[model samples]
Target: MTVADAAPMPAGPGEPGFAEAVHVFNSLAVPEPAAATTARTVEQVRSAIHHAARRGLAVRVHSTGHGAAAARPVRGALLIRTALDGAVEIDPRARVARVPAGTRWESVVRAAEPHGLTAAHGSSGTVGVVGYALAGGLSPYGRMVGLAANTVRAVDLVTADGRHRRVDAESDPELFWALRGGGGGFGVVTAIEFDLFPATTVITGAAYWPGALADRLLAAWLDWARDAPVIATTSVRVMNLPDFPDVPRELAGRTTFAVDGVVHADDPVSARRCADDLLGPLRAIGAPLLDSWQPDRPSAVLLAHMDPADPLPILGDHLLLDDLDAGGAARFLDVLGEGSGSPLVGAGLRQLGGAYATPSAPGGALDRLAAAYSYAGSGLAADPDAAAALRAHCATVRTALAPWDTGRVVPSFVEDFEQPQGHLDAERAAAVERVRAGVDPDGLFRQDASPTTTRQEKVP
Candidate 1:
């Protein structure tokens, strides 16, 4: 039966339902659409699309709204906030998982761990699964398993015509390719099925030292990261944490350098050795103020990064960078480290190599990031003046590191819509466009495309 046959209408602006439907994780980028609705099933998603088509409204899709800041404005559109109803289905023997849209990584981790398996999930367990995986996710296990998008075996989405299609490498290779990391705009994804890797326990956590030791720590970390093992994925950050009850006393209101990541292997002994190889040199530089690195179940990996649980106004910038030499390292610390007087709460580089540099056998549009490290800096925007200051600092940092910038980005890491974001070359982008045009001929989902990947005018 078609949605046109029978379905509830969406809520217009100012309606109670509209308020609930437009909820987002980033307070700074709350969407104001012409109409909105929550879709808990495929039938509801089809109905929302049919409604938008009849009203001549463009369609936009989001789940947790964690990437709301990076998305194009939803003005004059009907936003479909997906909350697909279902439990994560795991196939232990096949080492695969089928996750419904609106589901979070925490649930998947819990489900997979029992079977001695885990998916390539990001640091924050609260991030929606569909958006992260589809946008070429950079996981705690990324260096070992490659981008999360490569693990996708199939996708189920409701396209513009209200047709329910399940595309995979065999059924429709082209669409499947574009859907993986072609910068979205395909349709409302209902569920995703991806391969899971065998993992039970892993050594993961964070270690911190005073900012005074940043120079030595930074140099030592870069040297180690250049030849770091594939079994370990780690990052170093300079943080200025707030004084909160949950925060450790030593870290609050102080500039500190931190190193955190995951180390996995077939046995506990090997995992410990991998952790020692990376942490030993830094420990020699100075005593740490706080250290939480330890062997634990895979679920502990999420807490190691320390992403906030509540929503906040965030402003930031991202870049995929080539190897940074001594000069580049000095430039980075000059703008964001110790005495830089930087407004950003956190700024650092994520180690990217190993599997990240290798292409997947049957990968999607964005299968791998060729860069050496991912740089990101962000600050809280508590008010208008603070927001402007954060923007200026982000630009300052961008300019300082321009020499090493690869002029590319991973869609998942992009924090703002206005940042220079591009993951695909011209040839690949054009190819993705062709598929988009075929699937959405009338541009119903055009606004949903990432500005960097499409020829569309930049959103002002």
Candidate 2:
């Protein structure tokens, strides 16, 4: 169909429904697009793209807006919020799922759990499936399953030319590769299909202890993380929680140390053994203030990280790092641990190794992470002053950990648009840019390209 044939117009700023069309999860970094619309169907998405092309407007796309903070600014651009209409369709026999663009991780887990299967979903259920998977998802099961993007089998998107295309390994291998972790900007993804893994139950949850023992606990956790079994993936964090209604009384208004993750195995006995091997030593150091680790359905993995559900102001930073020695660990604690007076609500390192370090066969432009850990720290940005404090603390943490920093990032873990981010090397970035040029020669979606993917200067 011709671009002129697609008839739809988006709402401009201050127009009716514009606010809803541009809703975002991170209140701190709300976008102000020149025009915006929510697309509930592939036809609607095509219409929006055609409208933007006709108007000479650059295009930006988002689903749930969970990554709004990291997304390039949408000023003077047409923003298409994909709320594609569909349910999560699962093929139990094939262990695959066809997830619509706006669908969240919870729905996939709910749909697949009945069949004893689950996608490599992130810690929070609210995170949109397409964005997370396409941006190199670091899941609770990352050590076992690898980057979630590697599991993608197909993608359905509306290119800048207003043509709806389904690209996959068999049909368009290069486009498929670029779509999976190649850093976006190819088109507006309408839906995605990816492989799922068999999992009935998993040992997952968090354990918190008084921050006074953070040093010893961190030491023990690091010792255990080295050569940890592939079946387990975990993270250690130092949290300074506010006294909110949802926060547990014991945890509220305190600086606490925590360790949480998932242990998946073929049998319950093996899962328990792995969980014990991880939690036993930490627990022995001192009595935990609270411990919720136990065997549960795969769905429980989503809640283990305790990510807030409601929209809120947030500012943060992230890094991929080499293995930490005692000095590195001490530096981490000095900035984010007890008595650091850090304004960040939470800061920590996610263990990375096992399958995460191994490149997938037929993987995308961005596949494996060579680092040993993923470090992230974030705080609530309630106002200009609070935001400044958070940014300052983020810089402090960054400086403290610079020695071990790999100077790379997992796109999904990146928290700020200004954060240094480069998941692909020069060769891969050049190749991704070539694919983008082929699909969007007019640069209609140029602003949608990640800073690391396109040669064009990004909008600050």
Candidate 3:
């Protein structure tokens, strides 16, 4: 059986074909897994890893398709689908959660909401909790708390040697560091335990304005961002959304500018005051056609950016930048702003620094963002022609911003396996390699599993 026929697989292996025993969400035509297998429990995962080792087959893992990259090639690997179903175990007293590798943030949010606590989740609620946090999650709440990986307490994984190990600061300190943000190389993570914040209420939402005010709005944001409190994190996007029923009338089929973010405070009253400090100045520049910022449940943070829940064939490019002064901002708007002939569906700048830039105790391999901003752009290319155009436009924007590019990348934002995220510097990468040697001495995972973690995406 081929990749196309894996769906509605047989209830048991060998009943029809062993290939049908696994489940995957993405429908890409390439990178077919040699034999799709499902792991319902930790023992199953360990067994699968051992089988791959004995047969000289590499293991590639997938859950839902939120981490899908249009350009990755998984042609001849054994794909381990970890939809290992389980609910989050939230220890309210300890303010921590042990999330299954297959779990999505939406479920975790639901689990934490009632306790007046929030996980350090990325913008999209559908993102896999394990992969996101392990890759240095850039949460909407990151500025207040550090990167999500910094909060991880422990990880339960099946190492390349097929041994189940619970690694943490005390058990296996080095592997613990690598697992946090270093990318997946040493083992197959089955579950993770990380800290959650005490956020009873938060001020969060999006505010959109007509695209015509691009210049003034961009200028206003540049000035305001400098003083924006660490209590909040935000991003400004220039979008060209398709006209669809789900899209509001004001934004449908129109180019618009929107600033969406979250402000976290201990109490509801404090949250509003901090939010007003940022919004008041922004509103003075140009009134918004849509203002959805208001106090609500902590779960509302997941909706601030309104990321789609379904899988998408996203072709994306990312660059970390130094401070965006007037010069840097002008160069940015020139390419992605009004009338740039850009084919991208959208382009935006996510603010970094604050708690994100600060160093923490017992830090992991991937720490501090170091850059002032992260510039990302992507297009939904359903056809070959559109796909080529999207890549070209990304290169064009990257060239335009070359002067300010820091050449650093965050592991989580690395959407394409072909285009490695290069999350570490040369020295750090070498150190991670040394650690890899310790755990995977023969490089049992070098071909498939290692590349996912060890890709060294370049500076141009």
Predicted model with the maximum lDDT: 1
- Compared with the true structure, model 2 gives a TM-score of 0.96
- Per-residue alpha-carbon lDDT of candidate 2 for residues 1-460, written as tens digits (9 for 90 to 100): 5553443568888997688889989988789999999888888898888788888899999988888999888899999999887899999999999989999999999999999999999999999999999999998998988999999999999998888899998999989988888889999999999999999989999999999999999999999999899889999999999999999999999999999999996687878888888888999999999999988999999989999999999899999999999999999999998899999999999999988988456588777988999999999999899999999999999999999988778888778988787788777877888888898888888889776632233322
Off by over 4 Å in 1: 1-7, 453-460
The Cα local distance difference test for each model comes to: 0.91, 0.89, 0.76
Q: TM-score for every candidate vs. truth?
A: 0.97, 0.96, 0.91
Q: Which ten residues in a row have the lowest lDDT in candidate 2?
A: 451-460
Candidate 3 local lDDT, 1-460, one digit each (tens): 3432233321233444444333333333234556667676777777777777777776777666455562246556666777665789999889999988889998888898888889889998888898889878999988888899998999998878778899999999988887877667677788899998788877889999888787888888777777778888999998877787988888878778889988886766666777877788778877998999987777898998978666456776888888888888888878887788777777899988888889556478887788888888877777888878887888888888888888777766755555535667766666777787799887665553323232344212
Rank order (by lDDT, best first): 1, 2, 3
lDDT of 3: 0.76
Clashes (N, CA, C under 3 Å) per candidate: 0, 0, 1
How would you encode candidate 1's per-residue C-alpha lDDT over 1-460 as one tens digit per residue?
Answer: 6653344578888886887789998899999999999888889999899899998999999999999999988999999999888999999999999989999999999999999999999999999999999999999899899999999999999998889999999999999999999998999999999999999899999999999899999999999899888889999999999887888999999999999999986587878788898899999999899999988889999999999888899999999999999999999999999999899999999999989989557599999888999999898999999999999999999999999988888998888998787888777888888899999999999999885542333322
Kindly provide the TM-score of model 3 when superposed on the true structure, using C-alpha atoms: 0.91
Residue 102 in candidate 2, Cα distance off native in Å: 0.4
RMSDs, each prediction?
2.3, 2.6, 4.3
User: What's the distance in Å from true for residue 23, model 3?
Assistant: 6.6
Quality of model 1 by C-alpha lDDT: 0.91
